[model samples]
Target: MPAGYSLHDFSFDLRQHMAPANVWVTSGWTSVVAAPGTVCGVGGCFAPPYAAPDSSLSVTLEVDGRELRDGVRAGIAGFGLGLLTSGGTWRPDRIERSGTFHQYDDGRLVSLGVHSRLTPVHGAGGYVLEITVENRADRDAEISIHPRLSAGQPGRLPLADWGWMAPRAGDLVAAASTSMTLRHDLLHSRVPAGGRTRFTLAVELGEAVEPGEAARPGATEPDPADRARQATDRWARRLATALDAFPRLETDIPGLAAYWHRSIASGLVCLWDNPGFVTTPFVATSGVDGGALCAYVWDTGGYAPHLLTLMLGETATDLLEAMLKADLTKHYAIAPDGTGLGVAYAYSGWSLVTLATAVASQRGLARGLVERLHDAVAALDARFPAVGELRDYGTQHNLLEMRGAGWEHVVASPNAERAAYLDALATLAEASGAVLPVDALRATAHRIRASIADELWDAEAKWFRSRYPDGHTELTYSVQAFDALRAGACTPQMAADLIARVRPGAFLGAYGVSSVSAEDERHYELGDTDWSGGGAYTGEAPQLALTLWERGEAELAWTVLSRLLWMGEHYPYFPQEHYSDRPAAPPVGRRANIIAGLAGAEAILLGLVGVRPRPDGGLVISPPPAPGNVALRGLRFRGRSIDVECTPHGFSVTVDGRRIAPEGGAVVVPAA
Candidate 1:
């Protein structure tokens, strides 16, 4: 592990947080959450009030027998968190925490100054707790620590999950223990005046099972301590690799580096590799929030680079190739059986463009993939032979409720996104040998851009208002305008002009950029649906930051990133969207999708360490000014692995050990 990107660097403490709150970690196939007690499942965790004795599904911690000194509850089914002994019944008088690890003072646990500590470890399919107790009195003392589990019932699975897919047979979950120095699940040791004892307790959530078989452990089971060490190291490396795998910001900015690491790490936990789904590695949330129960284009844009990098060979190529087959304009989400699941939003093509950008960033416009992209674009164009420009079905279906502009007008989002798609289509045709009418595609895209930039730019309000069929601009400041910027809908001066109006009492909120500007109270609201107003859709704010960074407003971009970083710090995993004035989701119906929250990582990846893959088969390296010495290493672009090293001294790039020359104000690494 390098100095900054070590295992402990990602550690955080939730002990003082409200009980039952969780911070989840995953192995892609398996997942677990840290709550009052270790919970293995989607969202079936609660504080105290445990189950009856020997319950089929529960996490238990038993110490001593009955009351210790006076009357501290112990050895009881569904215990109340305490231990009893001779001198004085022990309780947690004072507890301290450092990065998920916990410590307790002496004399509060038992007669002989019983001091204790807890260290948490995450395994491939489970989480482990290593509990240690020490005695400091003159005489010897006896201690017993029993970590018990009773999982898997007759029909019901112990580990509960938010049903992302239709229920299948053999939803089995298991539990394992490595009681190295214990008898019958009990760890007993006589602690001398200055002696100590330790043991490990672990629980696991397995992968999807076959009808008649049990679930399988995700990885090879190692000894408890080795498992802990190895898991920690792997996670550290994964986080560090994400820095290089995607784009990483090398800065000492307070909260920036840690925020970036966690932003990328959130993607790891959000991924659930259930074999039953249409896609093996699903982008659905692991019962957190955001209701992302299936693979989504919106999510693929944010986390795909890290996953794509891990699958650097055929698997990577195959996955990116599949994006062309995805019906981005069809459904908001698809089911496990490959059928549409959610709304067929009008601007759902935004999802396609989002994923398209991700694909471009990872693989560039490589020849073979460009051929596939050409076919996909041709088929997409085939749908609009008579519809003139284009318009998807469903009104006000961009993200959620849109009362402004009747939610059914000639909007800017889908137009901007379509222009992006068509623009990419033309560029892809030019880059590869694929034959297509590039001139027509470019002309159509330009016409759309011209229409938006000409009619939609509200000179009076300094915002791109949604336009209606009546040729009038809608009154409101929407975050979707930011989307237009992402799709190259705004000229440089126009982009600056639009961004200049984003401030405290307008589009910018205390948390991040609001879905609807502050003063637009008629349309702005703290509702459940995404961007359903008055709040920051956790994902869009990152896009805003990335857009700002692209426009050379690094400071403003950092402003937005830092505001959302506060959410990541407060909530271990970022939620879908939150209110501007508070750290909470909308008041109405809500769901969890760490995938949306994970977009924060994309801002870090593409913004600070900006490495964009252009549609013309070239990779662009144009990062924001670094306040310190840092580097983005091992970036796999256009089928070639490259490194971007930057410091206060000078920034440079190397492709396969050959230093490359900077061209046109940025380094353009040509396809190998």
Candidate 2:
């Protein structure tokens, strides 16, 4: 371990030989490659953008006339350190390596510290290779410095002027479509005993134009080290601020604390701020530069509440606005061109209303913003068709139908979500002071609730069923029915029945609650990529867990939430979906997925801490009566910082460091 380094740091290590070590600049333009047989570039060296090329960037080092090419070990460190080893059979137990990824506030700059040390032997000495790659806002340049280094070309370089010069030679302009390869014999430097050297490689895509040029004015390029330090400090401040603003939960469960801390940090990183695109500044579904770069409406909405807790109201607002801007009222996915695509799923609109209400209720949205959202909600609600006498809306498929509906039958889950959305609309209307048909909305919500109890509830099966247009029903067990619990559509007995089915070997699995019953034959056959049959879509798990907690099933809710947190430990960050059987395996879809990350982080505050925001702008701190004593601190509400400490005796609260007596001996405070 090194200074400013901890195991909790999000990192990926290259355990095998010649494994690909890729690093992406924060600008999302350049990828620094250190893998064997690859060409390392700063700017357009790789693809135009997105990720590094398939070919590896090659580097050969020479020390004291001895060429160190084979059996050499190298690693690319980002946000943390990971050392790489040569593909040959060579093992040196005396060498220690570490590194850290640093991101600057400019959104176009990032750096990493690649450090190594050789243990003292009878005649052994110290050696250091300091490698730093910085994306310059100025002209394009690729600078690589090693101890008398000779570079080899393992693959064909794209047409670009190429040449070998002194390690400290000045910048040279190259012609387009020019290519050159430097031999290892062109090195003449060496490292003396107890000596250290710094290597710098920079590649700038001078041709890359700044998107929305007006958005970035007077951008100044700083030294890599200074930028790195500034990035480190900024991240530190962010984490500290998050801890101070959100409630903290410490439990006796193993690995829970570390997961809590990492989720908060990782959630912030998922926010992308690139301009020129509709999804710019929107939260990405995954950290991957490839297919997972786009944002999903359902996923963004799932994570918005947790973002509010962290005082990231702007990010939540941006995401919702992006979706509406793409016309989510009629589309399932928002295209990069700001156009909506695919038929609007029922859950997507429901998510919009839900997230809108949360943001407005938390005062995260301005009155004008709320007005826009109210209009979007009204538009989305108008798209739903009246399918039955109940006037309850339906979807072609539920959230589980990621690809498409296997059966075009009316589903209970979407109707339940619609009920919740109607409630949210009423709340948002009241909060935003916007003119809305509140009485009609409430009456419609009541009809939907009653219809859920009469038409969807399977009294004999003791669960909700997906009814078809022909009056037939699919009696398969689905965790989605729990949405009714959150929508206030379930009866006391129905809620008890749903709670009982959430146990392990049924709907619950090792990782989290399964989408379908584990005992179902179709559970194992669901499509691996999206929500299909039985696997747990990490984004939806927490909603059910939160509902369970609110419905007085705190123990069962904790069981689901803790399992999801535990599973999140395996990924560098939280992922989109995890298979029920392969709980510890890497996610089947995107890595560093934001939806699940946001949802999981929110579970800590909404489920464990019980920090629910009221429509009247007041705060409520009513943690469940679980066995463990809980302490929630730094909850921001009505411009005041609140803290709550719970014990067997009762809970004590402090607002802005002043002790406040609870109303009726419970932690309840009026709106500031």
**TM-score per model over all chains:** 0.74, 0.74
- Lowest lDDT block of 10, candidate 1: 45-54
Question: Residue by residue across 578-619, what tens digits does model 1's lDDT show?
Answer: 776655665434443356666676666567667766655467
| Candidate 2 residue lDDT tens string, 454-522 | 887889889777665567666766666777677788889988888888877887777666776766554
Candidate 2 worst ten-residue window by lDDT: 118-127
**How many steric overlaps are in each model, in order?**
12, 20
Give each model's whole-structure lDDT.
0.51, 0.50
Evaluated at residue 179, the lDDT of candidate 2 is 28
